[model samples]
Target chain A: MSDQKEERGLRELYDQDPERADYLAFGRKTETDRRGFLKGAGLTAMMLAVGGAIPFARNMPSGLIPSALADTPEDFTLFGKTGIIIRNDRPVNLETPAPLLDPDVTPIENFFVRNNGGVPEATADPEAWTLTIDGEVDNPLQLTLAQLQSDFETVTLRMQLECGGNGRAGFNPSPRGNQWAIGAVGNGEWTGCRLRDVLQQAGLKSSAVYTGHYGADPHLSGEPGRPSISRGVPIDKALEPHTLLVWGMNGEPLPLIHGGPLRVVAAGWPGSCSQKWLTRIWVRDQEHDGPGMTGLSYRMPRNPVPPGAEVPHEDMVVMGPMPVKSVITFPDTLTDVRADEAFEVRGHAWAGEHEVQAMHVSYDFGATWVEAELEPPTNRYDWQRWRARITLPAAGYYEIWARATDDTGVMQPAVVPGWNPRGYGNNSQHRIALNAA
Target chain B: MRGRKLRTGLACACLGLMMAGGASGQTSDFGGLPAGPGQLETFGNCTACHSTMIITQQNFSRRTWDEVLTWMVEDQGMWEMPSETRQIVLDYLVTHFGPES
Candidate 1:
């Protein structure tokens, strides 16, 4: 498709001034700066086309205009073009309902999207934005995108970025959290300045224990009014060798919705702490208290609750990396046997920070366990991919479940604990039904 | 505010027209029985972060709705509201969205 036509089409469609549609859609292709305009417009359209295709493919039910201008009560809720559908935030038992894609990469187009507030509209220029680092630093610095790119020794790392609520649907009596599907994750090569390098340049003092990062997006109606989703990283994690102030993702500039211009890649930290649209960082002697930090939401129960109960105050634990779990992405059928004699069973497994020590597969729903080959961990913090093959024990219906244990000995629960108010931490054994011929 | 009023009027007019086309045949899952079509209004409030499919797909009793609201407030981190506002939200759900008993 002609990039110019696509850009003109989008501009005409979304342009606030309805009359601008004619100008954008059919205006005389002006001779002035036409080449540069087409070039830039082409790039923007390419980005939007890829980004927009995602919602239609999997994010939600198609065609949801952002809440910024949704006219009616119904329009406010539904994105008109995308197939993504939202549910009333309530607690219920959620099962991971879809097949996974590749074991290593969760494609951006397929990654599940879960935001406390609605996804913000894309910005025109993230590079023009600035990052302000202050608080307990020898030098409080304000740096721009170009400056960040050129100032420090840059680094790249392959990491998995997952929302804290990535597996909320796996819980029973699902808690009220961002009702995300399996798509709330992505594997990307994040490139940027190491946060530790930046901190060393600023010269962190001994008293600095916690660091806070802020983003540029305004707190809007859809999110929690007070606690915007920002969090603190311990000085050590902040200064970890691979911790990054990322600008590029998957070999390109970061997309606006994914925290363009700048965002933190705190590999393995809950998606909560990798602040998007990051604009500021503070080194504090004590813990910080932003809404994303000690907010009433996002806290996990100190202990598991029954099927229908609340977490007592003393039992509240902060939410973190998803529990170790796996899923079957192929042959998501109950009984239709495949004629292909070789039935390959494969899926993805991830641990928050610990290495996936082992993955056990059960053809008979935990009655017997078999060893599955493991893909090396993505990073110390990211999840890893795993695969295995099984010979059909005669053409028959079969149930498959996979579980993983981290180095810390955390095993997937066969049955999830009771639901809490905020749905968090749903690391249950994932089961799928299939038939072999 | 004027824009909202005008939009509201226009929406009500559209809904009235949809209803006049024999409300009997339209909107299948919801009962034709009287309790009022508060579905649109309830949807407007619930979808800030959530999708309406959450409610449409659910089969729950009023007690479950009450339990859900409590869970929304306590677990999902929704801001607590006055007892009266809570009652209005609950009544709306129970009246328009009671489970099939």
Candidate 2:
């Protein structure tokens, strides 16, 4: 049928002049319809017979395009594919508790997958990447992603990256990290260009004072060839103007499974310094031997190792920032009671860079304490979301606890000071047991 | 004649980019296996960066894939094959995924 009347006359000439569409023109064109210009010359001769004169279909190379449809928001449910779906769909328990997601965002699809080696190769050329800041710098730059978007000044915050063994399955006998469950920790916004405006546009010479980074992903597969993960910061958290080097997220771009064009969002530390798919930065001046820094791998033994203890080989250290915690999340654990009904005690409280400031519920296991209803100030280490309301008066088997307190008084430590060999900070408190109507 | 219709539209756009690179190297699933006698002559070099689900999601044991192939050939540069092709890719990954034995 004359190519279906030349595709209904080129969709009625792009529904009648869609801004003179020549497929949104790149230039030179003047066909004037010889039957929809021979249907745009038979769809440009069927796209040059299926592309550049088919040298075997021009090497069919445009594949691997799923990072949730690259660049976000197809009704943003955090890049679906079931890798991160959460809106109260709970199931996170890497080893104890840590599932917060909105007290000020944690959704990179509920962040927290911490792999020492896995999930890399989301490429299709993020503009053929390249960052490379270079060790102990004076000038060694390299950039390119259109020279970091026509040279610097981009900013955009929202922090909280997490991962220092994010609750290593509550460690008691199980150590060795990556049991991760508090959904590791996310919150993005990001939009790049900062790490102190590219380390003060590469000048820093007061003996640098640490910054390190590095990430091109690779490694795993019989492992070892260096580049997988690297960490560092503390040149005053790399000059903190909201320490970045991102490359957009949440608002788009950045999504090589979350770490596209670049990464290193830091915020308040532990998520092993937020270094994903990045690519070198260096700067050090001392102390940062990388390899998860002076080995003992993400340490943490200041003291607390008895439940099956086997750590020896010298007390450990590193794994820092992350303590005041809390969690209960809706009367879950025993539900179905009404002898005296009176529920409502939602959960979520965090600490890391400080400012959770309160959250002290207990009910009957910690024995005494009550004061929940927090959810203010969302950023500066993120995570505060809370909600309370309890009053049973009769029913039996109950427990319910939660405990938080930051802004530097640093509370929430009912027990945890031991489980090293790689099971970093596992703040202890959350307890749920519901049942009353 | 418009330069022979622009040299027949650039020879039909170079035969449509060599027939889309021969229909994407004929649907690459590591494009047809064959080279297996072993000593790991790079059985498609770590599947060009992984997937054998990183050696069948390892449970480990051929002394942990020979201490992870001797730490990726002495600290991450990997590619020093021939110790009889790394004992035939550590004997076909501990004989078809070790550890369960």
Q: Which candidate is the best by TM-score?
A: 1
- What DockQ, on C-alphas, does every prediction get? 0.08, 0.03
lDDT of each: 0.58, 0.56
Candidate 2 docking category? incorrect
* iRMS per model in Å: 16.4, 18.5
**Which ten contiguous residues of candidate 2 chain A have the minimum total lDDT?**
A85-94
Instruction: Supply candidate 2's per-residue lDDT for A418.
Output: 59
Error of 1 at A247 (Å): 1.4
**Best-performing candidate as measured by lDDT:** 1
Point to the candidate with the largest DockQ.
1
TM-score of candidate 2 against the unseen true structure: 0.28
Per-residue accuracy of model 1 over A13-70 as CA lDDT, tens digit each: 3232222211222221223432112234432332232232121111121111222223
* Candidate 2 structure quality by residue, lDDT tens digits, A75-114: 2121221234221111111122233453355455445445
Candidate 1 structure quality by residue, lDDT tens digits, B1-101: 22644544444443344335422211322211224555444554554434443554443456668877775665455667568767776777776555442
Error of 1 at B13 (Å): 30
